[model samples]
Target: MKEKQIKQFEEALAQKLYKLDTEKHARAIGEAAYIDEETFISPDFFLYARCLVVVQGKEFYEYVV
Candidate 1:
């Protein structure tokens, strides 16, 4: 796919997911930034965790922003 086409697709998808409150949706068990106990996961893993970080970018975009 071309760059512009990819950008368009991303914009469209981002809007559909924009309404979600990721923090509330995600399960939080440990303090972010620094932790010793429990394993920390990407916020995108709230519902489905992907083995690859790139595939999980949607969650990262939704939460980290």
Candidate 2:
């Protein structure tokens, strides 16, 4: 890709990344990972989890959301 196209792609990815940082999605991650009342998850874990979900591309993000 050309320099301009690469910049555009980065900008688009940033936008999608911003959109994925939502309370709804975060809650979903926590809910999905829940394995009884003793299960605990850290804030950093959720952040990384959201990043993984976003990198899976639009199709997966939309499906998960």
- Candidate 2 structure quality by residue, lDDT tens digits, 6-53: 999889877776787766676677555534446675767777887898
Off by over 4 Å in 1: 22-42, 47-65
Cα lDDT, model 2, residue 64:
74
Each candidate's root-mean-square deviation in Å? 8.5, 4.5
Model 1 lDDT, full chain set? 0.48
Pairs clashing within candidate 2: none
Reference-based TM-score, model 2: 0.60
TM, every model: 0.34, 0.60
Evaluated at residue 27, the lDDT of candidate 1 is 39
User: Can you write out model 1's per-residue Cα lDDT over 34-57, one digit (the tens) per residue?
Assistant: 232375655554333222322467
